[model samples]
Target chain A: MNAKIRALISEFGRLSVDVATLKNEADLYTAGLTSFASVQLMLGIEDAFDIEFPERMLNRRSFASIAAIEQAVSELLAEAGRDAEAA
Target chain B: MQTQEDYLAGLLEHGLLFSTGVDGLFGRSALFEATVDGLNALVTKHGDGFNAESVTYPPSMSRVDFEKSGYLKSFPGLAGSIHSFAGDDRAHRDLLADLEAKRDWSGRQKITDVVLTPAACYPLYPLAASRGQMPKEGLCFSLCSWCFRHEPSRDPARMQAFRQREYVRMGTAEQVVAFRASCIERGEAIVQLLELPYHLDVANDPFFGRAGKMMANNQRDQKLKFEMLIPITSDEHPTACLSFNYHQDHFGLAWGIKTADGEVAHTACVGFGMERITLALFRHHGFELANWPAGVRQALAL
Candidate 1:
């Protein structure tokens, strides 16, 4: 979990130096992650998790912070697991 | 060197401009018709195994669809939305008064579910996605769509509303790349046949925000987008006649378009600004179709 968080932070940090300065839960918009960058970050997250992100989850709120992305990822993974079990 | 003004003046004397303006809302005419014919002729001559299949799309698209495709996030400034009212007479009166006052009436307005499609490819994605999996070979579609842009300019190259002829293909990475490459080669051949001086150059889409900028840069470096530019008015600066775009797995993922193997498909598109190309032809050739080259005329079947 710590390693996951660090990986997330490192990706966010590449987007902005301010992300590294933040203690926790920094607003991504305030951290200088522009909309285009957010999409790139989402692509990165998708690659990292080896998961296809649904269209519904693509929005400013979902990408607002490292914590938010982690939470979304966890939810997606849980949903995927449920789907697998049902299958 | 002959100036654009000088050529336009000659065309005006030939009654080409007036005829174009009178016959069409968007300055279309007999000359324009002839130019389109010429283009078709050029396409047949140069396009490898050209099979012309035409499609006309609705002027508007579902706003929800665009939202799903992330268009709203990228091009909010360029997008135009439809609005309507569902209120009493007093509310209607208030809205009317706001309209009369030329104030911000958007607050009183409720946005409709649809928006005017800014380009032809916007609608094709949904159709392609619905198919689930594309064949290993490819799916090819031709569309002539009415497109709208919010920012209107007086330049003939830049119109508030225009027609676009686009060819879109979806398939495996190799197929998509091959499709774009073929389009580039054919586009250059067509330019040569038209006897127009042109150049093929790397181009970028105006992606929104900083992330979009980075993506644009990546696209540029990868040569994912290319434009065939020809001078219309001035010899110094040129207008883009055709554009070839390679969207590697982007639209495929967004729209759930997959290959036969269940992997995301690669997509590419060739867009021809019918009017801009017509304008270029007119600027290069002359107003009289009879005076044009016999080879060009025969190719157009004119």
Candidate 2:
């Protein structure tokens, strides 16, 4: 899961720093990821995880960092799993 | 040897755009009007067989609809609510006295039901909703309107009030996404036909605030918005001349725009900033249409 999220960030995040060198909690925007680039990153995460972000979760806190994103995606995946089980 | 300011000054001098000393408001001269009309016509002809329902709307729309559409959630700073003098004669007298004394008199005006339409596509969703369920094949609407934003600029391209021509698609996700892609292709082709060199790139709306930054980032990450940019005020930081946006059920769920199957509809819109395009044409092809390359002139039929 860590490797996949990191890879997605590197591929679509348009970050200035190398993904391998940075800590998970480092501020991506401060390090050079633009708002435009973060959007690209978010789409990549959605595709990789096969999750559609609900409007309630479309805020900045959802994509604030590698850690925050992982939490959001993990929670979403868990919810979807529960939904599928119920279905 | 020419700067953007020089180019803009040339526009004013040539009477292409009349400047009232305001940053984003201008009057179009006969030549400018002809060029805009021709360009709009050319675009319409390009999408000739889409069978899009053409709709023209006044610059203002119902404030209730505007608020319900979640416009304030995304762009509170940019929305302009209409206000008018809703006072009796005695209050009017005070207002006039205040105005004559050059004091604060705006208190007399009350907020009205209308807000300046921020985008050409604003009213379409509600109007479509009123018609009941969207068809299985979905709907496509061609719209033209005077849109307003509070951000004023001297760049001439970034006007506070400008006309936008848009084609909005509503349907299932597959249909709307496909429609958006086709429009991007069309936008690319149109700019080329106009002979304006541009770069197409993933883009985001200028959402406000710290939280808004995240929203923009998410939007960019999703690849939901793409803009065709041309160098106008600055070559290094080119301005967006056209924008293609996929709303992805944001409007559908809010306004209860549902497909025939009762699922939330997906939406996308391709917007052409008319004044900016007109400016870009003048900037790239020189102020006089006669001096523009023969092909460009022929395409616009100028």
Candidate 3:
């Protein structure tokens, strides 16, 4: 998930720095991630993880780092899982 | 004045704008105001035949709806949320002291009920949905608002706060798309009437990130956004004075705006950035409004 998240950031984020050497928890914006790029990354993450990001999850902090994205995806996946189990 | 710097300096010299020492925020001079009013009049004249429901929104709107509009999701960098110093007496005193000391105390501010209206038509979609499903012919509305973006730029055309006049159409895919095309045509006619050199071409919203890159490319490939650009600061990279956008089902889906068949209604909006258009006119006709061509003046009813 970390690798995928990083890849998505690199692909969509328009990083001003080297994505390969960047740490998973490093600040993406400081590394050159624009809000436009982050939203693109969010859409890509949704497609990759089969998770629809709820409205509340859309913000700068949600895509602040690879870890933040992973956590968000995990929460959404877990919610989906619970919903499926309930059904 | 061939350069961007020269053009900006010229506007300043001509007293077209009253600077507040901020790059993007400015007060318009009387002639500038008249020019904007002229652009507004032109837009109204051109859009009259469309039979749109005229609507106007306050410069501010609900922050909640702004979030739901996916504005922050897409353009958080440009989003302007109204903030105020909501502090106790001590904090307020500290804020004043910090200001007196020339320290950055803006962080002490709190977000208010208002988010600056990003687009003129944003509030309309939910309003349309609340009235229940759209009819077969769909709906059309005209709106004008003072919109805000956070981008502070030296370019006079890229104002942080600007007025937009928009005619929005919501209906089936065919209806909305047709409306966009008509807007493109109508937009072209007005540009011609103003006697300004312009080029209308496919454009994309500046989406963010790798996914946004793809989205931008897709929008262009599908011919979803078209910009009516005119030379402002530069001839090579003209500013978009007007835009024809086909939002497809994005707004309909987001705001629960549906057609009579319970299908997500496709949406399209054509917007005229009044200030940008006025600037374009100034760029073309020179700074003195009195010296402008009689035909152009007559076209704008100035």
Candidate 4:
């Protein structure tokens, strides 16, 4: 597994553990991924990625699942790379 | 299963001590004093090493100001108006006589171009806008303002008249998020320190109309708001004592809050209901200030 993906999963697992017991593929919502917790997750992701999540991407669908969160992070990283190169 | 009325009566009987005469809409001295002491303790402890400057605002705001910010357009239902007698005393008496006779007096009055601020932070946005660009990091302010609402509900929790203590920050998105998160943490800490049982949950502001429903949905989806609820009476449903909100770029775009680099600044606010929190404390600990826990009393320096 990619180190970034592993860290993300581990962090999500930790948060889920704090609220409820969860399997690796357990639905995050059922695992207590509340709206407030989603924000905390976003913050954690930002910290782990060292990138600022844009306002446009701060939405429920973006943080709905582990796969969605990973996709969002990849997009942000790609955008950051593009911006860096453009600069 | 005590009703809201029973809860309020219990507060009046055991918890509330009036420090000032109740001759007017204002001047509930006991409540005010307790509020000040509570806020002082909160700021001194959690807000240590932070400059705590205070701000007072006018009871009413210019209609044009609110209009410019889309408040009137958004919340016409909650807006309160100011009016003046356009005619002489004789005409006013005649109008009063007509009112006594069950006739309309609307034509005899002129609605003034002002409205009472529904919340403290409403006025600050314009001031922040006028200040131009925010510093790269941010600007933090504490505001206490007299706010009025037209909701006729007599619930003490839903007062038509109240005071709001607000802490506002304007800066980068990262700063705004961090600031809001810190407030949530500190709010939970303070509630626990006071030994007040509470729950943290997502909450939404009362938005105006159909558009408001959409706005609220967006706010919830974005995790723009969270509240700390402490039961004033029952544990099943609790009253909100503190709320933390992150206004991503909404107010920044509206009020022109900008970073030193000229980008729109993100904004966040932490609001403490001075009166409601006092009411909650009274509900939990009873009226005698002496009976409050030693640690709680010591923390408040009471």
Best by DockQ: 2
Q: Report fnat for all candidates as fractions from 0 to 1.
A: 0.14, 0.36, 0.14, 0.09
CAPRI rating of model 1: incorrect
Which model scores highest in TM-score?
2
TM-score of 1: 0.72
Q: Which stretches of candidate 4 lie over 4 Å from their true place?
A: A1-87, B14-32, B49-53, B102-107
Residue pairs with colliding backbones in model 2 are A39-B217, A39-B220, A39-B221, A40-B220, A40-B221, A43-B221, A43-B222
lDDT of 3 by residue, B1-28 (tens): 4676688788889999888999889888
**DockQ metric for all predictions:** 0.09, 0.17, 0.09, 0.06
Q: Evaluate residue A57 in candidate 2 and report its C-alpha lDDT on the 0 to 100 scale.
A: 70
Task: Return the TM-score for each candidate structure.
Answer: 0.72, 0.79, 0.78, 0.71
Clash total of candidate 2 = 7
The deviation in Å at residue B251 for candidate 2 is: 0.5
Docking quality class, candidate 3: incorrect
Q: Candidate 2's error at B169, in angstroms? A: 0.3
Q: Per-residue alpha-carbon lDDT of model 2 for B1-302, expressed as tens digits? A: 35767877888899888888888888899888888899899889877756799998899899999999877867889989999998799998999999999999888899999999999999888998888897789999999899999987777778899989999999999998998889988888889899998999999898876446667767887798999999877888788989999998778877899898998889999999988898888888888777899988888888
Instruction: Identify the superior model by TM-score, candidate 2 or candidate 3.
Output: 2
As a whole number from 0 to 100, the lDDT of residue B143 in candidate 2 is 90
- Whole-model lDDT for model 3 versus the true structure? 0.84
Q: Which lDDT tens digits does candidate 4 get at residues B1-302?
A: 45666765665565353312232133455654765667655754685533545667887888777777666655678778788788988998989998999998777888889889887888888888899887776788778777887765434565666667788888899987988888888888888877888888888778765445545566786678999998875667788888999977667877788888898888898888877787677677766777888987776767
Candidate 3's C-alpha runs over 4 A off are A1-87
lDDT of 1 at B175: 84
